[model samples]
Target: MAENPVKIEKKKKKKGLSYLWIFLIGVPIGVILAVLDVDMGFLDVYSLSDFVAIFILFYVGVFLTINLHELGHLLFGKLLGYQFLMFRAGIFSIQKENGKLRFSIIKNVGYGGLCAMIPDEDATMKEYAVYSLGGIIMNLLTGGLFLYLSAFMEPGSIWKMAAILTGGASILLGIVNGFPFFSMNQPTDGMMFFSILRNSPMAERFYESSLLTKKLSSGIRPRDLDLLKDFENIGDMHDLTKAFYLYFQEMDKGNRDSAEEYLLDVEKNLHKVPPYSLPAYYYELLFFALLSGNLEKAKVYHEKAGKILMKDQDINGLRVKAYYAYIMEKDAEKARTLAQKGLAMRDHYPFKGQALYEEELLKELLQKIETERQGQ
Candidate 1:
């Protein structure tokens, strides 16, 4: 088993202190106002009684919103040559390794699934564009459905109110996820990108892909197909294979600057991409830093890798960080500190649950560092 990646699980703070306050915060205020003949008191009681209606509205809104968004991502991704791994919601239960994609569903009342697309790292911008679009399309469709449903629902009744809330939610979900934020050039935005190219160089590439994809295909021969033996890794199966292949080319050509520049772009798209494939793109930067014999750059890359690994709370990442501290940073003391921390962390690793490999490496690295320090 691999080590878990989460670093610290912070305790959740109590909301409004306690559940007993649920009544104090709600009932008393209503009683005081009702005694005063205030309509607010009656409305509060009425709303509380309508919890079932509100709950249903919220649930349907969240589910349909997330589901439609996910479908939007899937459809666009597929259209752009990305292989779909899973459609589960909320935090992406879909897992992929090498070329195999697995789907898993996770659910809870009033919570929507976090649909994910774990495509190959080598997938082109086109595939990414579609994957992003899939979510937007889903949201748009849901919003439209809700809008349509509102017509049949009575004007101010519970069903009508639910329809209005859900429809509005769907529209907002589609629009928000479509907008580019953080690093991800959201699927909806990508659709917009496809629409209004402006005068950027990316526009030309888009035009080429749009025109070429219509007629261009590898048309692999039987012999060529034999070379591509892994049906699972086939282009149609996972786009990361292509992304990986291109990453290598970018690395081989020593496009270190270009590689670093592209790395951020990929990270933003990482949300739509898989976790495993993400590091491969980062590896391109790691390779660049290593090849240049720039210890500082290497150290930076190692720390970046550690952060990624830390998300899984894997002890191995700590071990890797330790090795970087010792060898690259020439800080044996800090290395020792990190080593012990990582070893302790291994106790809870999800995979293997042991730091045998990292421990061995740490020992070897510590010895070498000590030897070098002693020689000085």
Candidate 2:
């Protein structure tokens, strides 16, 4: 009943964390104590100013840990041909200059350093890992470099402390990413590790890719609409063709109004999708209309969908006859002519064996139509 509804409610991502990083608050409070105890320190021009300096330092420390962790991922990705997209290190945004993204190194009391990374998708899978391992390797190496430099440097105190903080942060990022946990998706932990014990790191990747492809090819099941609603809250168009067919299936079962709404939405949302997906989408639409007894509307939609299909999309004689005879109400001679032409194309294409019922029904209907015309 509604005019052209668009069901573009792509699924959204959720925060899977148990809680906010509130447990880290203690580290900042502790740092305030350390800064306050320093005798004759430049941090305090006054007593209140001393507290402010420590608090500021505390905030800076926490900020650094998060950034460094993300940075590990970011730099690793780029050095390995990954293009960095965005970083979410919390306190500060990293700036990119001349193909190099900058970093902010801050040492914290209790927590480790933080960093962010964004990777480009253009590189091969092997190249992707080179980026993935960058953060962990760099942090470990930097900490060691600092230890050696401390022997020759006068500020052994600052470099030593920096190494301790940086080292911890680096190890934390590496372990967390390499842990082989369900949540981690980094190449080393997620894709690469699975490749190891299973002896096929590309196994999960291949399976996921295959599943998603098959899902699109088969189209969405009618019962899957409730599940698909959440998908719209996300980006969109990962499964438009299947979802649209599912909606059409809903219409097929006598829910005309709901089907119409879904079909329109799917059609509009498909504007951004590939043109290759259109033929199947249109076939489903025409099928739904025929089942719903909307012959006239089916004819209109059929033409729209039909104009987009090449002769290769379908080679089914029954479908061609049914489309012409039932949808367009064309004469039997013309309908049979088109059906025979379609059947000729089927010489190289077999009947799939699954459409046995539809094939029989189509033959019977064509014979009946021919008989009726003869009697007249």
Candidate 3:
């Protein structure tokens, strides 16, 4: 399938920083407060200890607010017959697998919290909108409640300050997430809500991807599932969701040439890619480059993705590192070690089908490394 000519949207650039309004407004006010000796009647901090306490409480409140936002999605999603797949806050995660709940610690960069749920097969657009906007609604409701409480509390009290700070944080979170924009390369709740409401093509792609992910989690391999037939003629190949599915579809079907073409296309139009998805994209490109013995291209992609590769503990990240160690660094022992470690993680990986595929890749890399060593 041939992609249409590139016509990028300039509005995406403007949308990138729309969520920074809180920081933009707060910084000037903070500077003004520091320049003046004015005692803000209700929010005055008297001692260094009080300031320290407020700071600590404010961070705690922010952490709690993140969890509350995710909880809102959970509660509202449940109301609409959506089944919870996972809930994650910071490094702690709880996921449902084989009808059982399991807790673990996992690293998910570029996100503060995540609430993943699968909608019912017969879910309507209204249900999706409600689920998507649930977190924002919770943030606003909690923010308002906290702000009201702070208004009634004693002036200059630590509790009052805590309430005010928490309220501000919650409101900020709500407003930032409620405004239609992309964060970490993924659309925000407001963006999803509006897209679903309008029944945009993006929304259709998003829902389709979610259904595909659910199938993956249920143990369906990419090679076994059919690709979206209509997506073959998609004009905007730069659309991440479309690119993602097509790339995987080709790769899983053992069409390396076609898969690499998709990767190279994404490389050329990277500005359209989400920031959070960059590392994974780079890793895949690096993998293909190494597999095809393109040392220079491998070097470029490895350099671009190096920071995340060094620290990302995901199964695929580990597999890529193992591949890189063998192909680029010529470290057979290190490659074997990383590949073994990745194999050990297969049982714990969230998506069983992907985990199984990664396991195969790691084993293949290990075998190749051994073959080369024996030849030497």
Candidate 4:
């Protein structure tokens, strides 16, 4: 696997200390309150039921605040005239369609929520910076407002406790997301903001990837995109996007060997990819493996790929399953049925750039199958 472009920066104590600090300080304060027999009123927890209630409340509080943090990004981004591409809260996604947002649910395999927006081609760094920092600003403001409200109330009052907990949740959410941290394939907001501030080439490349992804999702084929530059190793998820583009572009042109070669390159470097994105490539790898007559490897890839696939929701996922059914299970009729369904769904498929190319490949395969049956 190719090494990650950005070194896992040594975890500086300051980088993630906000979350630790909040909990560290918050826990002790809670313990002291209990030991001192402080009658905090509605906030006082004396039984197992109260503890469970508190747990559930915190869970809901965190969920809402986290989503609100993402909403903050969307609200400010839209205000700045940036195109809202996608808003995701856990497994649910709100996609922009026909100039309106549409919500869809998917398997919850990815971490955290996201509100992704696209800037104008001529947008400035300052604009990007403001948009990037939007979530943290909202988090701080929300948390600060509630914190201030709670300060005026009696400690044990329900409103005071609710406000305090919600505010703390919001502040903690801001700190965790705002501080630099690395997920398997993505960076925290603080990391992304700082990376762009430093003019990291990876950020620009990732932005380009996002633009390409948006275009592709909107039904534009990769081959149809007019580009001044070709995809190269600028690092980050952009490499995966480029690989997908080039792989399908070559496949559509009947260059199976070249496509397989590209797929192999992706396989070798998958460690550089994020965990959530790894499954998509695995699906592609499964397809390519089957195409190249490597049934064993194809089976392995398919097993791993299936874990993250949503059959009814993902048109390309159906295509992957179709190939597996035919090539491995020897179920030509089932495969043909799925292939037809996939072809019908092509224009509406997310990642329509690859969808179009894969559709062509499926047609070619069906024809080949027919020819083989005729010889029999």
Candidate 5:
């Protein structure tokens, strides 16, 4: 598929720190006043120790608030017949592995998380609204309940302070995340829900694209897949998704030249994709270059991808490294070692289901290398 030059939507420069952090920080100060027996009318008598106590409790409130928000997403999504892909709270994530959830940690500097749910075939505006509203509703109700309960506690008590702090934090979370707004160039849950409610075209595209991605990740072949047909008002992520599927389809049908051409087109428009998606793009480019016998180009892409893969090592990258070692460098020992490592890790590979063809290619290469060694 050939892509024509299209005008990119220029994102407006966001001009403020996110409210999430402000709420997370500010709620603790209110709780400290209650704890110090210093009424809000006159707060001139609080000690430094009270401030330190508030700081410590603030983090605890933040942690619990984040977890409650994400849990709302997970439980509500599941209730709506959405398949659970993963649950992330802050830097920690739990992903499905061999029919079980496995915990893993990653570096996420921001104070946010997500519950990735696979869209159902019958998904519509109702599901979208419900799923999006889950987290906010959780925050509001939990915060409200805590605040109400705190009213029953005696003044200057530890329980009163804790309840007030937690309630304030949860309310902050609800207010900040519940309202529709963009943060760091990404849409918030409320924004996404509002789009669906308003019948925006982009909302439908986002929904379809998410479903397609989940289907592909679950090992559905490209021949059975159908998505990304819309061209008008398509965003960069949608374009990347289409390119990925089309390139894989071409490769699966043994059309190496067409796959290479399509990949080159994707490379030209790579700036459309976000930074986190670059590793996959480079990996695909390297794979295609190797198949096309363009060793030098393959090496360049390999180096580019290696920098990103250093943070989150992958089986595909390891397999590519093995192929490069054997084919380009002619280092049989190094190739064999890397290939063995890739093959040994059966459950660790994230995209193994979707990359059946790639896995087959790696196995074939390993077998061929062994045959050559035997011939020697």
Candidate 6:
């Protein structure tokens, strides 16, 4: 089916409200700053070099703050008996694959940094809370320390300026991340912490999802995993994690109708899906659209996800591109080459189950392409 007009209008209205919310937040802060007559003397720069140095220092501070926040999550997660699956700073990532650490550069999709850790099978809410709050605590402590040390340094000096910038960045990071808000559709540390404290269904779903991720990372296929057996209890079928797990489970079990239903539901709420996962989501929609002979809808999805499909190095991204090449563009050789590239990365991809699935899909595409060519 084509995209729903009413759903599109609702999505537009939601986006408008998001912008309105930002404006509302900014207006109060601006009014307060103006009313307080905030001093602007510190920003005075006599030379271009000075301006450049200040800019560089500011970015350095931001970089350091982001890393520290992620590091905080790592440390706390480890303390809570959670195992690290991946750590990402900007577009660079270190992932655990087959019990080995592998470093790679990835396409950045809005996230500044992330620390992905899976809790133990018997993990409790207290542990989850601590793990969630770890980053905020680190940020607050470091921010305070930097600000204090800066006060001891000579005003306007490079060292003092650097300290001030870093300290300010750290404090802002703490405040922003500690507040319950969504950053690019992913919950903040503070959000997660509070949710866990409240013992919300979302928190439980998140915990279950983490366990599911751990299993996937351990080379277990979705069909073999029992972590999501109670997925219906999540109370929100539209929840991205729940929908994704259900889709994977049904797909792995060869229930195409059930899988497509989940994907279509996800399509209706694409705004809730994280940017990093958009390519995969769109890929699934596009793949199913093609299989169901909905060429127009398939083309629309392909176009919508074109940028990511062309540039994304992930196995799923490659698989979609290959599928589109053969099915839509009718470029058999291009499809085979793209599929082969995805197959080559299967061993090193972070999620073993996903990698294996992509490998199988690619192989299937390759076989289809060869059969079609032979018939021609």
**RMSD of each candidate relative to the true structure:** 14.7, 16.7, 6.8, 6.0, 6.7, 5.1
Residue 255, model 1, lDDT: 58
- Residue 242's lDDT within candidate 2 is 40
> By TM-score, who's the top model here?
6
Q: lDDT tens digits, residues 1-376, model 5?
A: 6454332222222123535456656677668767887757533344577666766786777787878888888888888877776777767878665446768775563446667777565767668778988888899888998899999997765566778878987987887786787554446778878888898876676566676766766677554566334543324666556767777777766777777766877887765665445667888888777767888998888887764444433456667777878878889888788777766654555444555655666687889888998998
Off by over 4 Å in 2: 1-62, 91-122, 146-163, 184-203, 206-376
Alpha carbon lDDT at 156, candidate 4: 54
For candidate 2, give the lDDT of residue 83.
36
Task: Evaluate all candidate structures by whole-model CA lDDT and list the values in order.
Answer: 0.51, 0.47, 0.77, 0.71, 0.70, 0.77
Model 6: colliding residue pairs: none
Estimate candidate 4's RMSD in Å: 6.0
Give lDDT tens digits, candidate 6, residues 155-174. Answer: 77776777877887787778
State the lDDT of candidate 2 residue by residue for 149-200, as single tens digits. 5466443244334444454544454555564543312233444544544656
What count of clashes does model 2 give?
39
Q: Which candidate, 5 or 6, has the higher TM-score?
A: 6
Residue pairs with clashing backbones, model 3:
none
Clashing residue pairs in candidate 4 are 40-156
What is the Cα-based lDDT of residue 92 in candidate 4? 87
Better of 1 and 3 by lDDT: 3
List, residue by residue over 47-159, the lDDT tens digit for candidate 3: 88988898999988998899899999999999998778779887787867534686876556546787888776677766888888889889999999999999999888888
In angstroms, how far off is 250's CA in candidate 5? Answer: 3.8
Q: What are the TM-scores, per candidate, against the unseen true structure?
A: 0.41, 0.33, 0.71, 0.73, 0.70, 0.73
